[model samples]
Target: MRRFFYTIDSDNADAPLLPKLSELSQGSDIELPDSIIHHWCRVLRANVGDQGILFDGFGGEYQVQLQTISKKKAIATLLLHLDDDRTAPIISKIGLVMSRGERMDYAIQKATELGVTAIQLLSSHHGEVNLKPAQVEKKLAHWQQVAIAACEQCGLNRPPLILAPLSIRDWLAPTESPNNKTAVSPIVSTLSKDKYYQVLESAADLRLQMSVPAAGQPAKPEILETVLKQESPYIELLIGPEGGLSDDECQKAESVGFAPWQIGTRVLRTETVPVVALTTLLALYSYNK
Candidate 1:
């Protein structure tokens, strides 16, 4: 049974129809475009009367029956809108400072697959993907498509938001964008300069940093032990760029109440750390969920 997430606005409660929300249904007529028609006819090899599931992201899943198999488009009659209830647990958030080339793509894809509630792009001193506003739009579209494909492949019903990009200095400052729309406040930011807290699933919030271990500082702590012993709802995760975060930024994050955690001794590629950290956090988050 292949599941496809879609949006449709038909009043019929008997059968979940194909999403003609974009093309037809001005007053009850349903239609589809050639692109989608070709997808069903040629790619899926679907014939008239084939049945499949459709979801409109709003917790409603529908079953539709293929009705019209036109040469240019395929149309479906909606039958029923069943409730779909598989959304990821709301862990904190993950913000990755952008890096060059395919690594950024890889990071976004894996982060979505790992069930992150939201992903924030970071503009840092060592950042990549620096472009004009127009170019930014193109990149954003590309990243969003990556996220969508990830959701399709991973079977996560609720799509996580890829928010408008952010600057490290601005993000580290007192105010930030609201990742949660329905919340009373837009974001978790405040006017006062306070510790930037990002709640992730892991108890031990880790930041991939520039400093390596010296000879004798204690590795784990009592606080981490206590939290790890039970479970934590939110965590903070920071992954630096190719060159890693500067000393000043790390000090700033530390001053703002972030704990320093190291996964291992070897340096992980910028993109790899988030996948590792996020997947680790997902394990912990799922346990609590």
Candidate 2:
């Protein structure tokens, strides 16, 4: 069946309320938001009896049939709740240095499609783009929308959490308590050697450094594969912007336990690294299983 997925904004209480997956049963009528109604009626030219899927972003999804369609609103009747879990077994978070325009948007979309659990926008010394406080708020919302759109298209019921942009220094700052947040393996892309060995030795979680190596140097996918074998439930990948991380920034990351690692021999663009790295990690995960 052609499954069209729509995400319900649980935060928007003003919208028509839909039953939770646990409370949902067959033959219950539910009203879809006007935005979804417009897409179905105006964009897709869906008829009254068209069928699609609805996900609340909690987990799982529902089979729904369009029972009523009009210029103002549309209603669907919930048929069944499919308890399929589509979440990735390994949680991946990408800490990306802000890039220009569509490049950042593309990274967020593709990363969500690759099943990243969260995205942290970071500012680096070498990054080309800078945002004021207002711009940060706006960009955070924009990137979040991009993630949601990616989820709707890619069959991900849960979208990655989009964090507000922070400077690289602030991002690496130690929190007062480690138990306050979920544990994550920290991997960073760098070429620094000063603290590399120490970071690797002390790393309790999987840490990666992605770099394009010099000629005759071996690729480190094998190293990344070995780290993945450690089976950390969550990993946070750090990729730099434009010119990549500066020397000082690399040192700071290493101080925070971000082990550096390289991918292939060729340099990947700022936006391209997330897609390539995520695909490699996900592929390695499946291969190991």
Candidate 3:
């Protein structure tokens, strides 16, 4: 299927440009935004009568056929709405401490492909990169774009939400009581002595003690299996920066019910950790289903 991604603009309420194609009908004339026209006509070299798919990133997608092509805008006739749900059964959110340059971009892209529900960018004591307030806004917008592009490529109907950057301490702070909230299995990738730890269904809300062990501990795949058996569908994952989380940071996370778990025998880069971790969890969840 030929699909294109667009973001909704708040200014134009009636025809909110490329992304929000709300008023679609079988024989209706839909005007494509300049950006969409450029990409579809100029970049993709799409001609009249070519079939195309459009998604607003809200949910599902639309099938259309190009009727007219021009430099100003292209027009397409809506065929039908697709109610396809491409979301994963499990709701996983990754708290990633920001890494430098393309590493952060790559991590966000891969994590979106793995079907994470949301990505919470974090700052930590041991984090190498620090961004100003202005820079944070720019980075957030950039990363959101990256996620949308990834979803378009991966056939994900809904792109994961990209939250603004916040400190790890603040992000992990207790908001409500566990009894009041749904049970969330918190997992942290850390250097721990117990490399072969298994997560039991009974220990769904267990708080694990933090321990520093040598690097190169292999990840236990059964942990994911145990998590999938739990009543709650949510999983909160914490991955540190290049230098990894400080001892204090680990303790703080442990205090908040995050269990320290190792992913591989050798240490993986900050960007590689989320991709590996999310892939393992999603694969196991899919297999069990």
Each prediction's Cα lDDT score? 0.57, 0.69, 0.68
Give the alpha carbon lDDT tens digit for every residue of 1-289 in model 3: 6677655543244642343555556667787766678778898899999988887755678888999987787889888888887876666777888998899999999998888777778889989777896686567768877887898788887677677777777766635323322111111111011121222112233232222335553245335566676554677788888777888898788788777767545778888887777776677666776
TM-score of each: 0.70, 0.81, 0.78
Q: Is candidate 1 or candidate 3 better by lDDT?
A: 3
Residue-by-residue lDDT tens digits, candidate 1, 1-289: 4455453322234544444333323233245544345555678888877876654344445567778786676677766655555554435466678887788889888888877666667777777656665666567656765775686677765555565566665655534545522111111112001122233222434332323343453343335443533443454566678877777887877766566666667777888877777665556545545
In model 3, the worst 10-residue window by lDDT is: 184-193
RMSD for all candidates, in order, please: 8.3, 8.0, 8.9
Q: After superposition, how far is residue 54 of candidate 1 from its true place, in Å?
A: 2.3
Worst 10 residues of 1 by lDDT: 183-192
The 10-residue segment with the lowest total lDDT in model 2:
183-192
In model 1, which runs have C-alpha deviations exceeding 4 angstroms? 7-45, 71-73, 79-84, 174-232, 285-289
TM accuracy, model 3: 0.78
Sorting all predicted structures by lDDT, with the top scorer first, yields 2, 3, 1
